[model samples]
Target: MRACHALLAATLAVAVLLVPVGAATTAGAPAVQQTPTPQVDDGAPPDRPVEVLTLADDDANRSATRETTLDVGPAVGAATDAAGHELRTIRALARVRGADDPDAALSREFDRIGARAAGLGRQQRSALQAFADGEADARTTLLVLARVDRAARALENRRERVVTTARGEGATVPSERSVALARELGVYTGPVRSQVAAALSGAEPPARVYVSTTPRGVTLAALTESGYVRETYRGDLRRVDDASLTRSAARDAVAAAYPSLWRVRSAVDVDPARVSTVRMTYDGGELAATVGSRNRRVFRDAHRQSLGVAGTDRQAVNTRDGFRLVVNRSYAGGPMRIQLRTVDGDPVAADLTIGPEGGESSPVGTTGPDGERWLLTPDERFTLVAIRGNTVVFITMDPLAAPRTERP
Candidate 1:
């Protein structure tokens, strides 16, 4: 019986030793294994192992041993249970220490996230503040500019209205408006410009085309205070307002006739001064004097007999103080005497010729055989000229091609 009891005891111990520690029973309930958590600490947590602590004595008799058998926990469980109060104390300590291990780390992560969020918020706030400041500055600048603009507009509105009148736009002198401006600016002029301006002021706003002529050329003035209408020119020979028109006519007429001619320097009209004296005389009591411009020419003819053949004894004559005389005769060659005379009857004889199919002669005096004397040259082509009633003659020619006749 003792031997059987011992064997049975040994078997029971072996069975107990085979039980798992993780499934140790407490109050008849299985121990539950929870998922492990990593505990952050200075040292690693202690690991518990499943253990077998067995006393299998085959020689021991149950009756002699006074067997009071208790079904303890598994081997590692029993050892842990034997130290249960201490294990409880250790677990409580571990629980308390676990806070120290991971608490700082959790705090650090949270603090990191909070700091990042705070920095982002500060950046956003700064951007918004800068935008608001820029808007304020722009509004202030716009207000100042608006005030300046209003002031400028007010000044423009306060500016005075100006009314002025002027007569001659084409005149050399200043217009009425111009005069006012000049006076305002403190300027002065001589008698001519002042007189002209004053005279113009009395007239209508648009000036009339007044004509005046002198020995040199004609003048045509175009005047206006009004903006509209083309200017007019006063002219008999040609339009004088345009210097080009005058020049064209002059170049066409005078340049071909006189080699000594040159273009006038100024386009403005001017008059030529009179020559001192011009006299034509002959051996007899006959004289013709012309005092004026150089364009005057004189022609003379002296014939002893009236008729010899159809045309005979004709001479072409020229006077020194500018005169051209021609003798037209039917005869091809003829003997003739020609002379230029002073008012006191002194003769300057000239070259004589005759080939009269009626050619042209220059502007001057001419006498026909009928004793008819023409002092002034005809403006058109001439057929005949002759000395008339024995009154001497003086011709004054002006540069504007005007003829002034006087009897001597």
Candidate 2:
């Protein structure tokens, strides 16, 4: 009896030692404890709401403008206008057709333009840098910019002609990368061009230039010594109404292209055939500006316009941490402007890091008091990580992604 009792005591001690910590033994069976799974919140909405807003009839004609000041001269103005005209011509040529080995032809043209534009871009940057360093005057810098713009525009025009001709001959369409490169070559100088034109015509260019768009068209305006000098292009307004060439048809077309917008606002007059002289309010001016920019390339293939290369591209997203992030890229591989703000629209200063998705990240810079930073974008898709205190937000940045037509 003593021997048996000793053996039982030894077995019990071994059993207790074998059991895992926090595990329970019931009826001589060990019960394993399970760890609860962790939950992760990515901050994206379960169903992202489409972002589009349309204005009421009373506000449809209104314009929203952003103003800036820059020195201008006659020579610079003429050169700027000439560059703008060349870019416009390139856009037109993209609608035309071409013949024989168009792809090969396009590739050669692209190489030529690429080489020339790169040299000009470098020159422009050097001149601008000199001006920034106070080594060059504003007039001199503007002249250099104008010259570069003119040369770049001509190169782009030549490339577009090749693309158009090849496309007509049933050659493969140019890639988005090529189109983006071309667009970068002919940066939008609308505001500068207008001011320069005013100076060229022997008028004192306004100290403040306002760039705006309305249902009527894109307008560049300023309060000059003489009066308010305004230049408007009705092309976009007309294009918006060209879907079926009728008011109702145009409304339906706008609805189809921008369904989210159609759901909200009352239909406005879209009669392309008649002159609309009604003075409109600027209810959704930013939205109008976005749509106007898009309208310029409506006739082109949907793929090219997807990049939003025709104008400034803006996108906004809400962070999981109750912040709003806005990114603006005028063209692919161009300077990207990043803005961080609270949900209430107050700017937030935060450190920003960027890298390829699922890859190592590097710190770029922090936003300033204005909650904005500008950086050159890479040609590939990447991710932006914004950190403010314990709050961290991740946003995927696809430089080639289609831009949303919503106001940011």
Residues 87-191, candidate 1: write the lDDT tens digits.
433443343334443433323323332343344334323332332234323222222222222222222221111111001111122233222222211101111
Candidate whose TM-score is highest: 2
lDDT of each: 0.22, 0.43
Which one is best on lDDT? Answer: 2
The superposed Cα distance between candidate 2 and the true structure at residue 23, in angstroms, equals 99
Q: What would the TM-scores of all predictions be?
A: 0.14, 0.32
Number of backbone collisions per candidate: 22, 8
The sequence of per-residue lDDT tens digits that candidate 2 reaches over residues 168-267 is 6777865654645554454423334445444544454424333322222223334333332333333323232222233443344445554454455443
Cα RMSD to the true fold for all candidates: 70.4, 22.3
